[model samples]
Structures are given as C-alpha cells and as structure tokens.
Target chain A: MNDVTGMPQTAVVIGGGSDIALATLRLLAKRRLRAVVLLGRSAEALNEAAEQLRGAGVEEVTTEIFDVNDFSHASEVAEETVARLGTVDLVLVAAGFLGDASLEVIDPESVAHMIATNFTGPAAAMTAFSQRLLRQGFGRIVVLSSVAGVRVRRSNFVYGSAKAGLDGFAQGLDDALVKTGLSVMIVRPGFVHSKMTLGLKAAPMSTTPEAVAGAIVKGLESGASVVWAPSSLMWVFGILVHLPRRLWRLVPG
Target chain B: MIPGDTDAFVGWGNNNATRAVHRRPRNTKEIAALLEGSSMCIARGLGRAYGDAAQCAGGTVIDCTGLSEILAFDGSSGVVRVEAGCSLDQLSRYSVSRGWFVPVTPGTAFVTIGGAVAADVHGKNHHREGSIAGYIEELCLVTPDGPRIVGPDRDPELFWATCGGMGLTGVITEVALRLMPIATSYLSVDTDRARDLDACMEMLASGDERYRYSVAWIDAGTRGRALGRAVITRGDHARVEALAGTQRSIPLTYNPVQRLSVPFTPPVSMVNALTLPVFNSLWYHRAPKHRTDEIQTMSAFFYPLDMLRDWNRLYGPRGFTQYQMVVPFGQEHVVRYTIERLQEASCPSTLGVLKRFGAGDPAPLSFPMPGWTLALDIPLGSPSLAVALDDCDRHVAGAGGRVYLAKDGRMRPELMREMYPRIDQFLETCHRTDPDGLFVSDLSRRIGLTPTTPTQRKGMKP
Candidate 1:
C-alpha cells in the first residue's frame, strides 16, 4: 500500500535531520511509501532518524553520509542513493542555512557561505536529481523555499537574498520540466520553528515543521507547482513583494 | 519539542485537555520501544474514546494509528488479521466489497480495531450481536516486556482483561477478527415513532429481537409524559434478492463521502435552547410514523454524522460530552427519571440515543448489560449540565447500572467502582500481565484505575 491515494512508493530525503525534512518524511511514510533514503552529513544522527521513521512504519529507510557542501559529486551521490532505495519517486530539498543576519556588513565570507548553502548547493543537487527524474519519465521534486525569499528585507538580507536566488532557481527549474513527466514544487513557507530556527524570536504567521510537511504532502498529492506553508502567506507575500523600498526597509527583522 | 509530534490531547468530547507527548509509531517495534522507554505510557487509537481513556497527562502516548494494516483476509472463513490501528472505516471499506463487514461497528466507523477491542464497543446491534470483543479470535499485545499473541482459550485472563481494559493491560498491536459475511451493503430498515418514554422502551424491548440492529433517537426537549418521546430505527442487511434494479448491479458499494463540514469551532454552540427544541421536533416529525422495508444505504443508517465532517465543532470551543449509561432491564424507569431530570434542570441535549443491550461480556470493565442504554450529547457550556449528570450517575448506580467508559469524560472513581463490581479482577489481570504498572492513562488515573497522584494528573474538575 503506497499512501491512501496509491501514489509512488519510493522517495529520497536529500537533506535529513532537519525538523521539516523529518516531518516531510513522516507524511510520506504515513502514505505507506515503500522505501526512503535519508542523505545527510552524520551517520549516527541519520541512523537514529532512520530508526524513528521505521518505528513510524516506513518499510525501508536507508541512511547515507552525504554532505551538501560536497557539491562537486552531487549527481554521483543522487544516483547512488536512488539506486540503493530502488526508485526515487520524490526528492525533498530541505538542506539550507540561515546564517547570522546581523553580520553581513562586517563579513563577506559569511554571506557567500549563506548563498552556497541556501542557493547554489541545493540548486546543483536538485538539477542532477531533476535530470534523473525526467529520464525515468515521472517523479516529483519539492524544494523548500522561504517567505523571506519572496521579498528580501534589510533585517535579514544576507539569508533572505540567498533564499531569493534559490526561490527563483526552483521556479525556473519547475517550468523547465513542465512536459518531461517530472514536476518540481517550490514550497515558500513563512517563519517555521524548526531546529534551524531554534533560538530565534518567532515572527508573525510562524508555522510548525509538521504544518509545512502537511502542506508539502498536499502539494504532492494535488500536483500543485507552488505551495505556501500557511497558504495565507501566499497573499501576505504577494503584497510584501511589491512594497515600496522605503517601507520594506522599515519592516522589522 | 517537535510541534506536531507533541500535542495536548483531548477526547472526542474536547474537554479536560492535557499536555502529553504524542508519537505516531508506524510499526509494532516502535510501539514496543515506546512502551519500554516510557514508564507512564498508553496506546491511543483515533483518540475516539470521547474522554481520556486514550490519553495520559505528562506521559508518552503511542499513537497506534501508524500501525494500521490489513495483514490478511480469508474469504472462505471470513477471518482477518489486521494491525490494531486499522480503522473500522478502512476495514468496512475493504471487507464490504468482498461481501464481508465488521461484525460490530459503533455509531461511527472512525474508531480503530485496537480502540474497539480496548473499549469493547457495542453497536446498536448489541441486543443481538454482543460487543466487538466477542468476535475477536486473537490479539497481539505489545507490553513493556515484549509482544504476545493471546487468545480466548490460550490466555483467557489476559485476553479478556485486554478486551475492555482500556489499553491498560498492554498496547494491542494486532487483532485477528472474524468478519460477518453480508449479501449486500444496503439495509432494509424500519422506522417507528413512540409517543413517550414508556412506549419507546416497550417497543425496543419487544421488537428488538426481530431485527439485527436497533436504536432510537429520544427527544429530551419535552418534559413530563413526552420527555423521552423517540423515533426508533431498526434494520437488517438487505439480501441480494431484495435489490430492485441499479442496486442489484452493485450489491456491495462502500463509498462514504463528506458533502459538508463545520470548518472551525463556532463562537457559540449550534445546539442551544433555541435550536435544540426546533431541531429535535423537526427530526422527530420527519420520520414516517411507521415505515418499513425502506432500503437505506449502510452509511446513512450507521454513520450519518460522518457525512457532515467535523460536526463536533458545532458544539463551539468549549466542546461537549456524550454521557452514555446503561441501566438494568427492570430499572428502565431510571432512563425516564434521568431524561426528566435533564429537562427540569433546563439542560438541553442536542441528541439522545436509546438502545437495548442484551447480556454482558466476560470482560469486567465492559459497559453493556441486558437492559436499556441511553446516550445524551450535551454541550459542556451549561453549568447545570455537570450537576444533572452527577444526579443521573447516582440514580444509575443506585439501580446497579454503569456508564460506558469510552463515552465518559467525568464520572467519579467511587461511582466507577459501584458500576463495575469486578474492577478488582481487572486490576488483578493488569498486575499479572504488566506487573510494573507500565500502562496508564488520564482516564485510568482519574477513575482510580491506577494509584492517583495529584501531580501526575492535572485539569480535573473538583
């Protein structure tokens, strides 16, 4: 049994250990996805997470130590992971960094790190997987973007700007695969309280990781190309994107 | 805390909310691990026990819904082995197409197999078919020690104890159930209106034997003689030959679609003094005074509430409690007195269901007995409601009657003892199977099933 809707039974979670990724994996598991591969940095952490997903009833969860920072061999890793998991039905890109927003003026390296982690690395990895999905003639790729990317603000410009690049990349990639039997879902969430955002003060309309996972699942089931975490944020960002620069700068971090 | 993983759980009543660690474990191993990890733990299925029967405060709640699976089904023998998390809805959807149906189903098919076994739920057909426990052939229980397959003849005490033990004996991982073969999905129903409490009870008692399923919708709107006036509906599965035309083409159609929904909790309850009387009267007068052989869809006859999704939200933010009690055969007057009491107290009930129960199960905590069972869905916002229910409890206890634990949110521990005389036996079985006292829930602690420590439990009304 592959989900209540009888969708594909296999999936691969590229960025594992993050709260939203785990939450997304759980949703897929609930649909009785036959197999899932958690590709991440730490073996022990991935092993524990694999046990957790297995306990939650996923038939097979294979963990591999693959870092997103190792962007040179992104396609090689994707192929290996998909081969190990049997078939890659869906690929969820949730690996990103929300670097120090206050230090962008003092540090150029920190800003570049943010861009590499949030934009360049994931775009490259998803590109490799997208080619595989098209070759196979049917698959889904869900890229976790952010509302911060919708309209970058001075409060967190370094992180927000990086997400902006990733957001544009995801949308363009989605359009590129329109008729290739492969689909790309760009998920733009408002502030999500996951492990990455642990100590940060909550923002308005902040949603939970589970809520994001639920949205992603709904997106996958409905074949929606673009999905907003709280959905209402779609309209909220719609106005924010067109805000006058003077007013946008006045908004708080 | 993982926001979605850990949540404050409330029963179907949505009252007495408690903060508990909730984990939806997907397999039997996960269930076992959870039990082993948490000293104070309980298994929850669908969270449909109306109250805290499936919840534990400041403890781990292993949500068994993840383990839902229809392992195997034998068409010839009508035997099925399913994970405890399998909902009656899922089972019915699958089995009905194969010319089989769950032997017993509650008012709603949303309940799970484990929950059905744990509560030993009885349907309208209780007068004929007993509780869900009777149809169980065997069960796989995951205890702190490990999983064990217990059956009636193999481990009768553990099996019986686990049946109505409210998930206290252990977490029921899987169940091998005996399904009932049906010729068609439609029911040949008969509807009748009774003038008063006496007429309702008398009609149910006399005519119930002729039908496989029987239940009445009683009106608590009118006081005095008309207080318990009701519309009774009884039915049996329509045989294949009973189908007229298009129905014959698909004798086993198990499609239940939700056409409407109460999207969010309303600021005020939809059921009030102004609405209750009008709705009840409309419902009462709508029934044919005496209609028979009316072919009704199985979903319409068994689960009408399911068609309107989240109808519970209509009770408003405060939610409501479904107080279901069963009194012995000769003490049927208690039902009338309770109805009159509610009316006098000015406590309006949205809906009241009355059914005849025949014989008790071997499980000590099982609710049914050979007598009258009346269930009232009362909004919790009414201050007088709780007091009136207490009075009803005392009246029921005085007559050796008991309340269904599954539908209870707030019945006193002392009253529980009075209602279930063999509670000690159930506790003894719990101790024997789980000597460490690993399985416990808010319902168990609130009702003194486990040693009550005020610190372990919170949100109990004095």
Candidate 2:
C-alpha cells in the first residue's frame, strides 16, 4: 500500500535490470519502501538488483524470470507476483529496446523485435497487471516513456515510434481507470545517461538516471499522470511537437 | 438517471476527491435496484467522515441523504426509527425539543444517523455509554443479496460487521436508534487546567467516572516540562431546575444554528506553523484555571466546531488529516509519545483532543476500547507529516492500538492486520453478507479490506 505521501511500500519492476528502475527503487527504499519483486529476462541481473535493493533497506526483495515477449504468461506472472506479495502498491514498466535505427529501417526481423520489446510486450504485461490491480482495488503503474516519443525524430524514429505507441497506450489506460483507485503515470526523459546510452551523444537537456528516478518519485507523490525528467521538457516539447516537419528534421539530437 | 449524477466527491477533509456516479435513492426499493445492477457501491450520508470511508472511486455512491425521513418515534420510550439519510442535526431539532437526544455523537451533529451507525461513532460520554452500536437496535440494510433487517439479536454477525464495517457489508437504508432522554438542552459543566501530561491523565483517570461526559484539549505546541498541558472539561445534562431565570419557561429549546461559516477556501492554510502556536497558546491560556457548576448549552458543550460551517477549510486547499487513535488502558504512553514525535518533526497540529473510551462492543472493526484515544488535526502542508504519522502508527500498533478508519485517509495495508486483530473475521462476515463483493469504498480498497483472493468465495455462491 502507498502511504499518506503516496509513496508505494511494495513495488514490482517488470524490467528489473533497467538502470532507471533500480535507481528509483533505491530512492523509494529510502522513503519507506519495504518490499519489492524484480522481474526480468535475465535471472542473474534480477538477483543482483534484488540484493542491492535489500541492502538499501528494502525488507523483502524477490526475483522472478520474466520475458516480456512471451505475452501468454504475462497475466499469469502478474497474478503470481500479486499473490506472493499480498498487495502491490506499484507496478513499474521499464522494459524497452533502443535498436540501431539505421539497420532497423531495412531489417524487418529486427524491427519486429524492437516493437515487441518496447511496445507490445510491456503493454500486454500492463494490461494483465491492471486486471489484478483493479480487482485488488488500489495500485499505480508507472511506464518509462521518453521525450523522443513526444515527437518522433528523424534520428531514432523506430525507437521513438515504439515509445510513442506506449505513451498513447498509457494515457488511454489512465483515463479508462479513472475513479477506479488505479492510475498510470508516464515518465518522459529527454535523454538519460545510463547503460543503454553509454556512448551516445548527450542531448541538449540530457539528465542522469538518478535525476530521472528523483522525478519519478516526486511524480508519484504528486499523483501526476505525466512527468518530464527536467520538467522543462514539457514546454520544450510543447513547441517542438508543433514545428514544421522540415524544420523538426533539421533539429539536432 | 439510473446512476443519478456524476460529480466529484470528497470526505470532510476535502482531500483526495474522486469522480463518482452519485445516486440518490429515495426508498429501499430504489436502493435495492441500484445494488442489483452496480458492480460496486457504498452508501454515503452527510460526508462528515474525515477520510475516504464514504466515497467509492469510479463506483456508484448511493447518496442516502435522500432518504431523510423519521418514520417512527416513540417519545415515551426514547426510540426512533429514521431513514439512514436523516442527519443528527435534524433528529436533535425534532427530539431535543421533546426531551430526547442522540445516545452517542461525535464532535459534530451534521453527521447522519446511518453514518453514525456505520462508523459506530463515540462521543465524550464513551467512558460510560460506549459507542452508537450499543444504542442501535436494528438497521434496514440493502445488500446485493437484497434488503433485510438486522440487529444485535437478529443476524448479529452482519449487525456487528456493519457497525464499523466502513460500509463494505451493504447500503444502510434505515436505522432504529435508542435516544437519550434529557431534562433540558443544557449541561452543568466543570473545567480544570493541568500543567503537564501526567497531571492531565491523572485528573481524567481519577475524576472522569463522576461525569457523564469528559474530554481534554491538549496544547500540542508546548514541549519539555510543559509538554501535554491541557484544559479539561467535564459535564452532565443539566436538570430543568438548574436553568436560569427566563430559561425555565422553555428549557428544552434546541434551535442550534451555524453562527459563522468559512465562505471559501483561502490560498494558503490559515492554521499553519506561523499561526498554530499562537492559536494554541491563546486557546490554552484563555480557559478558566478552575471553574464549576457553569450552565452551558448542549451545542456549546458537544459541538462547538459545528457553529462554524466548513471549518475544515481552515486548513486551506491542501486540506488536513485527522490522526485519531486508541491505545489500551495500560498503553497511555503511546498518546504522549505521539505528541512528542509530532512536535519533534515540527508538524504543527491545530486541534488536539483526548478522550477515554470504555470497553468496546462486539464490532470487530469498531475503534474504541478500554483505553485512551487522542485525535489531532494536522495540516497536509507539513513535509514530515506522513513519516511522522507512519512512525506513530508503528508504535501504536506495537502497543495493540488502532487508528480510526473513519478518520484515516492514509495508512499502510500491512499494519492494518496488526492494528485490528479481528480484521480477518470482519472480512469473513463481509464476504458472507455480499459474496459478489458489490459493496466497497476507497478506504476499504486502500487498506486491503476487500477480499484478496478468488479462492475465499469458492463455496459460498448461493
């Protein structure tokens, strides 16, 4: 359950190995988070993250093998996890793939994999969790979206489009669950420096994983449906999204 | 018009407003109709509860206030059968003039009879009279299964469950309550000022038994040697002979009206850190050090805050949360520890009240017990308010105490089982009464009161 400050006591991270998810869980542990269940495709990474969370003061930390692409078992895993935890205050969807856009444009197989990892798989998992959460009566879901999805750019249209699909899905889910004691929050970071973007050129307003985690924590406390990493990205995208396509393409990454 | 109107509803605290479909059912037939088709629903009265106990998010909120009719009243026997919507204010206006009053009332009279029953509200007289559950003879409940009458003797399981069930069992349509007979609408009161926590507790423990009603106003701002300094007030219904000069002619007069109201919410809380200490000091110092045999109106003694309509808005747009908890007789130290922790966290509380509760009834979820209960109103603006309250909850639960569900908007689900040891029994009764799980409220869902597994209802489908 979430406390008076809306800080979740127990959380389930779908992509437990994601840098931002681990950082957010660490920060939440400092703010009264007691238990967590980390689910990911890699058993070793999930176990490592669970150990780190336990060390950070989370009383209970468990790991489960989860492959988002296996849509058949998504709902089953959600039910099992909820049964194990008794009540989950939060379910964070932080799984995504940033494929090489240059090669993905021509590689149909890679494109399918990217779309499955970034959009379809996470959506399936969230939908399943939503059913369980609605039945249990109260819980929140936070999905890691991106500013890139706010307006798909020429540089990374494939990854941006996948995130765009997820952003729209989450927004619609939030509205559908209105007054149901269930909510969905979307986090849009301009550019987060993490394992996924280690050698990438830093965007103009790029932020660190810890900053993004801080914003997510604050967003949860404020009951915000959408949060921007630097917060200024809300306005930056307000104008950038409306720019002429020719000019939008010319804007640097 | 099936679901009635769609609007935002909030508890008295004015926080966490949820948009719900509101239905005003005029009779049991209509209520039964609403219950049959709705996936989830809960009855709402005057919304006096400070938290989410009354509001069901995204679900149907049957506004029982429409059923505001006094069906039967035997003035001689001091018993009244009223529609669940009938507010205590209305009941008092009708009954007090006829030498009768509600057996139990919280700080306010605006709450409905059904709400009083649902929360099993207790007044300052709880030390002697117990909660409203003791006075509730029967109730007309409309559940998904259908409408039926329940009482202490008939369907006692369901009756006790509904007492403090937080409206999870079903929608209450009517209540048969036993009122208290009174000679006049005035109280012979006494006041005493205590210098510290021990003195206040000692005075209450030693002298409270002599009075029918007792409560203490603790100054939370005071710390160190002066910590928990309080002004205690104790009283009993004044006899007609105690009335002064002209008042004797019509001693039962009960025309209590709102003297002042907060017209609108201010931009910032009026009861903030800057002004709270000043208010506390003035409130503490203004009281008579020791006074006795003072004739006071019943309204003045019982519901002074009722004189100011929407007084909750004084906390401003962010609103405030009332932390009310009860620890058993031997666990009085938790009361002082809570105040100390609040002060240490710099959480300025505007109002602090202390009362002693007698042995609790059979209701598993009922709040009061043979213990000391303290209630404090803290503005939501305090940064450490949540942590401080959580810390208090841990200690209170460790001491076998529980916070009042009617006043709780924020509490962890894990601690609920620890706080209310019989919560599983209450849930079992809820499941048996409404197996489909049609009745629910935001508070129920937030605290994990709703059934967690589908397996719990496997063999019970009738």
Candidate 3:
C-alpha cells in the first residue's frame, strides 16, 4: 500500500501549531505517516493542532510544550520527541519570528530574543535531530526558510537577519548529510498568507501554507535539495539578492 | 483539536452555497476521528456533485481529496485499488496508458471515485456495461461503528446502500474497481443525425447494443416537429490496427494537455435565452449528417467539457443546475414531455444528453435502471427555473422515473419518496449502520433523510 519510499510512517513537527508546519504534517499524513510528535509553544494551540491532525487521519499524535526562544531546552525537546515517536523518518522545522523590524534598533534584548527565537534554538533542535537521523541511517528534514532571508530587506531586517542565519545553517547541514542516508530540504516561501500575517497587506505572489506544504512534499518525494513556494520566487529572489545596495534599499519589505 | 475552516461551499453549479466547516482528511484515521467527534458531518470528494450532496450546512464536511492515491494496480486483470478521492480523470489517464479504462464514467471526468460510487453514476456505455457500482469489487468505508469492507456477495444490503448512498452510509476510504481493458486511447465513432425525438429514441433502442457506447445530444431549443432533434453518436475503443497513420506508433498515450481555459468568471452568463438558438443551430449543423469510423481521442468522446478548464464559470456567478432524470422504457413520453416543457418554459439548456441504461444494479438507491436517461445543464438565472424543474419532477415520478440525487438541489422530500419506491428499505439500512445520524449531508437533510429524532437517536450516543 505504501509508495516508492514506503511512505514515511513516523514524523516530528517542530513549531507544530504554525500554519506551514501543520500543513506539512497533513501532507505527510497523506503519504501514510502514522506517528507524529508535535512540539509547539502554546499548549492550547498544540492541542487544537493535534486534534486537527487526528481528524486528517494521523493515527497517533503526541504534543509537547515547546518555545523556540528556550535555547537550552531545544536539544532536549528533539531528543525526547525522537524517543517518544521512535525512528522518525521525517523532521519538519517551521519555527521562526517575524517581530517588529524596528525593535533591533531600540533594544539589544529584543534583537537577541528575535535571534534566539528564529535561529539559535531551531538550529540547536535540528542539530540534535540530525544526529539521531544519521544514527537511524535514514530520514528527511525540511526547514521553512523565507524569501526575506534570501536577501535581508531593510523594512524587516531584524526578522530577515535571523532567517538569513537559519537559512545558511540549513544549507550547510544539507551539504553535510550528503550520501549519509539522510537529506535536508530547505523551503523558501515568499510572503505566505498565514495567521501570523493576517493583518499585513499581502505582497505580490503571496502563497498559502498549503502551497508551501505542497512544495515541501514535492521536494521530499523528488529528493530535491531546496524548494521555493510559487517557484517563480526562486528566480525573483535570485536576481534580487544580487541587487546593488542603493537599489536594494529602495525595494519594499 | 485541529478545527476545520468554517466557510461557505458551493457545488459545481455555483448555486445554493451553504456554510460548513470544511476539513480535508489526509488519512482514514483522521476521517474516522472526525466522524467520531463531529455532531454531524459528510464526506466530500472534489465537490463535483452538481448540488448539495457533498455539503453539510453548519456541520462538518470532510474533504477526501487529501486521501487520493493509487494503492495498487494489476495491469493484467485491470483491477485497481485506489483511495476514494482519486478522480476518474486521474484513473482514466493512468489506466488508459496501461491499456485499461474505468468501466463506467460520467460526461465530466472530474468526478472522484467516491462521488461516482456515492452517486452510482452511469456513462455512455451503460447499455453495454453498467453504472460504476457494478464495476466496484469492494469498498472500504468508515461507518459509524468503524471500518467495514463490503462487497456484493458479502453484506449485500450495506454494499448496495453505500452505492449511490450520497455519503450517507459512510466515508468511502478505499475502493477496489475492475477496469475495462482497451486497445487504444482513441475511440472509433459512428455519428448520425436524428430529425426528431422519435428518430432519436428509435436509434438508441435499436442500434445501441451494436456498439459499446452511445449517447445523443438533443437540441432543446428546437420546437414543434423539430422537437428533440439530436446528433446521435455510438463508439467503441479504437483498436491499434484501426489507426492508419502516425497515431499507430503510440496508441495508448493519454490526451493530458488542456489547451483552453476560462481564467475567471464573467459578470454575466454566456449561456442565456439569446444565445441558445444560435449556439444550438451552429452545433447541430457542425456535425456531419452521417459519419462512420471517425477516430477521436478518448477525451473528445468521454470528456469534451474537460478541454476547457473551469468551463462551469461560463454559467456566471449564479451558476447552472444539472437536471438529470431517468424514465423507464415504457414511459418514453415523459422524456419528450420534459423536453417540450423546457422549450415552453424558455429554459435554454446546453448539452441535453440522452442515453439508454440497460439494467439496474442491486443498489436500491442507484439512479440508473433499464430506461432512457436525459441530462440537461440549464443556467440558473430564470426565476421560473425551479418551478419548471419541480413540474418535470412530478411528470417523471408519475412515469415511475426518478430525479438523480446527485444532480438535485430543490427536490421535495415527498416527491423524492414517491420517485424512489424503495426509500423505506434504504432508510432501514441507514438506521442499522448509522443510527446516530452522524453521517448527514445537506442533501440528506433537505430530503428528510436521517432525521435527528429521539427515536432515531435511541441507544446511539451519550
């Protein structure tokens, strides 16, 4: 009944309550992924997300309290989830922040918080999970990287900078997993329409969590190194990333 | 815990949009979990049902599209096990490439297998084959109690009940279907022009069995002596040797390119009273008076509408209603009367199709029987459209015919009971399987099916 890769039967979703994370989980479940461990900040949101996953036909869903800002606990979270789910075949990390861009200029603590929430803690969790996957000798990891991180825009530089660091971390991790029976796929989505961006004016080529989920699943199925939601954004950002400093500053967030 | 997005959903016909909580279940466990938790919910696949059969107002609507996957395919036997959410279009293209085809398919290939099973849909080949239910080897359904595998020989009542059950019996998760083997992806067709209703009926009655598939396109706008003028077409799969030229090299390649599309819904419908006669006249004359062994792609023969994606938007924002009904062979006058009534009512229906169904399946609520089935796609801008359709309903019921539940939106409960003589039996079976009335849809409620009452709810849930 399983597809070519035998359809991943176990998975772990970091930042599980986030729209893109939950969407990716649903896509995985469709591929017959049986067991999942959801790690998220809000207990209420995690419970609701687990219920939703159950409705979407995931056989077993376990949620644990997690905060991406809690850097010291990141590795523990990964270890515990892996121990609980057992032999996780897929790990999807969609933990990040889109905090006020101006906060970096006003306070150092705010800048640190943004970096910890978006980069440090998530990177720690991925590092822990990556080691476990290598020991198991077969697994896939998908991390949600934003187009904003492709080339940090001044309007949201603080948030973009953290994603920039995480994006680079994912790329390095992907290279390190070469031929190790493990793989990493970094998803770059531009202006996603989600609860986090509800009130914000939508940017051109804005995609949905479902769209990003589709890209991630397609990447996993094809064993692609990276995926871009609304794929055109890959080229758009490719050219935009190389723009001269003066011209790039004029570009909106 | 994962609450679904509550929104208004409309059928293919953009009419009767009802608010419901839409949950797309990725697996059977999720579907079962939703069924267990939701007070009321109905399983929907692709939302291709022309009316509200897939919608549950103020309740949960489980979107089964996420469950789409071809589990297994035996090319030798032409048997395929697929998730119910797999569309006929998907299966046809996949199987046809392997020298196999779905046993029965509706005009639009966009319909999901779950919808096809729930509706008991028939195709142009009904005279030779039967409805989709006949081809279904087994069905794995998530009932109120749990999962159950039902087949014709085992649990025949539940099997028949689930067929054309309109998602009332349960959420169909997996279906094992027996596919028809074909030599090529093209159809060798014979076309003939019928001058009137009698000529059309005569052609279908006498010549249908000669070919594997047959259907007629009646010009509903024609009146008086020309009433029911039609272009009758009969076809069979073109053998590899039949293709004389370049097509012989790759006989089984499926036609997948959809070259045309309607990007957006126009402010007003393109199909209206003013456009009917001109379009009908042009269409009727376009076909040759008589053509034999004309080769056409399977898409051209089975799914011409699919060529232009989102063609339904042509009916405009109000959308269109498909009134498909079947009248027994003895009551052929009802078909004629219904066509005349549409003409009098000034309801310009496009693509008025007439096909003869050969035999009825064991499914009690299945739509097809040994009869003449006429389907009409009438745009829904006219104020008198509902009344005219209801009037036709009575005429059909009087003739021992019934309106298709899949195509119904405004049918009365009493009339439905009258049309379906075995409603009591269908209800009794539903009670035994889904006594709690958890599997409810807008169509079921509108027609007084699975009425939530103290007696019905007895020994059901806390």
Name the candidate that leads on lDDT. Answer: 2
Which segments of candidate 3 are over 4 A away from where they belong?
Answer: A1-253, B1-4, B452-462
Lowest lDDT 10-residue stretch of candidate 3 chain B:
B453-462
Model 1 bad stretches (over 4 Å): A1-253, B1-5, B454-462
RMSD (Cα, Å) of model 1: 15.6
- Model 3, span B352-396: residue lDDT tens: 999999998888788888899999988875645655776898899
A1-253 in candidate 2: lDDT tens per residue?
A: 5544667768999999999999999998877587798999999889889889989999989999999999999989999998877668899999986877874454888888888899999999999998877755567899999998999998888899999999999999999887666789999998889988988998998999899998998887655789999999999999999999999989775
How does each model score on TM-score? 0.64, 0.79, 0.64
DockQ: the better of candidates 2 and 3: 2
lDDT of 2 at B376: 94
lDDT of 3 by residue, A1-253 (tens): 1112213567888888889989888876754466788888889988999999999989889999888767677767767776666456678898776777764464888888888888887898888888755544346788888888889988888888889999999999988876454567899999999988888878899999999887777665444678899899988988887899999999775
Over the true interface, candidate 3 deviates by an RMSD, in Å, of 22.0
For the second chain, the TM-scores of the candidates in order are 0.96, 0.97, 0.96
**What is the docking quality class of candidate 3?**
incorrect
Q: Per-residue lDDT for B227 in model 2?
A: 90
Candidate 2, superposed: residue stretches over 4 Å from native = A1-3, A9-17, A26-193, A197-215, A222-253, B1-7, B381-383, B452-462
